[model samples]
Structure formats: structure tokens, C-alpha cells
Target: MKIFPIPCLEDNYAYLIIDESSGEAAVVDPVEPEKVLKVANDNGVSTVKLVLTTHHHWDHARGNEKMKELVPGVRVLGGSFDNVHGCTDRLEHGDKISLGRDVNILALHTPCHTKGHICYFVTGKEEEDPAVFTGDTLFVAGCGKFFEGTAEQMYQSLCMILRPLPKQTRVYCDHEYTEKNLRFALFVEPENEHIKRKLLWAKHQREANQPTVPSSIEEELYINPFMRVDMPEVQKRVGRSSAVEALMELRRMKDNWTR
Candidate 1:
């Protein structure tokens, strides 16, 4: 399986998950349909088979109608609870779908950023590494703000649901927030060398105009303070005892954070 990230709007990302065995692809948040189709055509994909809408947000789901108009029979899918603009199908949690021959997609209900935010976990039947499209639920070193949910929901979505994925599973999120997120991670855990190194690396990547996503679950555990609320370092910095409190404080701090 091959995944291509297409930059859309300001910092948003649209991803293409292509099954190599066949020239079929599933696109995630194709907010810029023309660019996405251009990339797809550049690759071996002749027709896009699926459209995976992560949330109901305009930046994420705005181009669904255009995609429908572009691809005649493409199956557009969104979470069962979300009112996605042009969704042809509503998906429940744990719904499994196949793309071409090797790509297997699983929908996970991670609903903190939005009430019906769905993160797509994808794996290949062959030897390809697994991946998860986290939308606005999870970033490189920070999770999304509590827009429509509480701290407990964010904790459950980030820690309980996403934290247990395979350590090497590549994480793909919705925005180009890695540099800013790593800065926040450093503020949360100033002494964490992992965060420092990753921050520097992210700096270099941004300077060179490269994407810093596809961060592995293991890397996030080490550098992402939101996912490490139980750690003594994170709790001490946040002055919170429990994980939920720490997570809430972190979210508050991030929400008010200027730099």
C-alpha cells in the first residue's frame, strides 16, 4: 500500500491510500479534489474507489460533492453520526472495507474533536506497514482541542483508543501542526530529550518544506505529551494528579497558548 499526502487549504492534509496490487485508491478528506485527482493520476490510480470523510468540518468535507461530480461511482463514506456533506454511506465503528486487493480499512470512532470524528486504521494484507488517519483527533505531538467534548473524551480517544495501536503504525493527521505541537511538547516536558530531538528534526523538516507526519505510535508515546499524561514528568509540569486532569490542563494550556 502507498499513501500520498496532499496539502489543502492552509494546513489541512488530504491523503491517498492506494493498493499497489491493483490501481485502486481511497482518498481521505479530499478537500482539494483537483489536486487530489492530479496526484492520483500521477500515480497508477485510474479511478478512486472510496472517499473517507473524517468529520463534518468544512475544511475536511467541503470537497465531497466535487469528488462525487469528478468520480462517478466513488463510494463516499463518513461516520454514521456525522452529517457529512456528500457522504453516500454512513459508517459505524469497526466497519471494515477493502480497497483493491491488499488494502484493508477499519473505521474507528474517535469522537472528541467532533461528536462523530472517525479515524481510519488501514493495513495491508501483504507485508506493508499499517497506518491510521487521525484527522483532527491526533497530531504529531499534540491532540486536537476539545471542541465538542470534554477532557475525559479526549483522554479516552487519544489514550485508550489510539494509544494501543501497534507501536510502528504510521500516524497521519489532518494538519501541518508538527512544529507547533513539538514546541508545546517541549513546554510540557522541558527535560524530555525525545521531545527536544523531535522538535529539532521537525524544525529542519519544515525549513526544507517537508511533511513531518506519518509519525509512528511509538514516537508519539515518547514525544507527545497529550498521549503521555500518566507520565510523572507531564503530570508534574501540569500540576495535575490524575491523567484526566493532566489532559484537561494540557488542553487548556494549549488552547490559550500563543506561541
Candidate 2:
């Protein structure tokens, strides 16, 4: 399986997951149809079999209809309650979708940024390592705002559902917010060498016009503040004992934080 990260509006990203064996592809959160189609064609993918939407946000699912119009019989999949535009298939937690002979994607219902947001976990015979396409629910060093759910819900979504994944699992989130997120992480843990080193690395990547995504779960465990809510420094910074309280305070701090 091959994953191509297509940059969309501003910092948003739309991924193209291709099955090399059959040259079939699936797009995740295609904000723009033309860009995704162009990438697909460039990579020799003749058919787009599926359009997987992580949420109903315009920047994520706006191009669903246009993509379907272009692909003819492409299936649009989203959370059961998302009511995403152009969604033909309603998926619940643990629902599996096969892309080709080698690639299979499992939908994980992780609602926080939106009421019905879901992340796709891709694993198959062709992949060297598994990957999770965490739309806006999880970022490289930060997380999405609680637009529709509470801090506790976000905690469960990140810590319970995502944290347990293999350390080498690559996280393909939907935005390029790594640098800014690392800045906040530094504030939360000023002495953390991991956060400092990652921030510097992200800066270099941005300077070279490279994408700073596809961060491994191991990297996130070391640098991401949201994932480290239980750490002594993070708990002390937030002045909270419980993970939920720490997460709540951290989210609030991030909202008003500025570099």
C-alpha cells in the first residue's frame, strides 16, 4: 500500500491510499477533487473505488460529490450519523472496508472534533507497517478542539483508542500543525528534550518545503502533550490530578496559546 499526502486548502491534507498490486485507490477526506484525481492519475491508479470521510467538515468532505461525479461508481463512506454530503455508505465502529487484495481499512469511531468523526486504520498484506488516518481527532503533537464533545471524550478517543496502537504505527492526521503544536508542547514541558528536538526537526522540514506528517506513535508518545497528560510534568503544569482534568486544562491552554 502506498499513501500520498495531497495538500489542500491552507494546512489541510487529503490522502490517497493506493493498492499497488491492482492500481486501485481510495481517497481519505478529499477537500479538492481535482488535486486528488491528478495525483491518482499520476500514480497510475485507474480507479478510485472508495471515498472515506473522517467527518462532515467542509474542508474534509467538500469534494465528495464532485469526486463521485468523476469516478462514477465510487463509494462514499462516513460515520453513520455524520450525514456527510454525498455519503452513500454509513459506517459504524469496527466496520471494515477492503480496498484491494492487500489493503483493508477499519473504521474507528472517535468523536470529539465532530459528533460523528471516525478514523481509518489501514493494515494489509502489502504494508510494511500499519497506519491510522486520524482526520482532525489527533495531530502530530496536539489534538483538535472539542467542538462537539468534552475533554473527557477527547481523552478516551486519544488515550484509549489511539494510544494502544503499535509504537511503529504511522499517524496520518489531516493538517500541517506540527510546528505550532510542538511550540505548545514546549510550553507544557519546557525541559522536554524530545519536544525540543521534534520542534527543531519540524522547522527544518518546513524550511525545506517538506511535509512533517506521518509521525509514528512512538514519536507522538514522547512529544505530544495530549498523549502525555498523565506525565508528572504535564499533570503539574495543568494543576490537575486526573487525566481528564489535565486534558481539559491543556486544551484550554492550547486554545489561548500563542507563539
Among all windows of ten consecutive residues in candidate 2, which has the lowest summed lDDT? 122-131
Please identify model 1 stretches exceeding 4 Å from their true place. none
- Tens digit of per-residue lDDT, candidate 1, span 1-259: 8999999999999999898889899999999999999999999796799999999999999999999999999999999888899999899999999999888999999988889999999999656779999999999999987887889999998999999999989999999999999998888888889999998999999899899988999999999999999998789899999999999999989999988
Cα distance off (Å), candidate 2, residue 9 = 0.9
Clashes of each: 0, 0
lDDT of each: 0.93, 0.93
Estimate TM-scores for all models.
0.98, 0.98
What TM-score number comes out for model 1? 0.98
In model 1, which residue pairs have backbone atoms overlapping below 3 Å? none
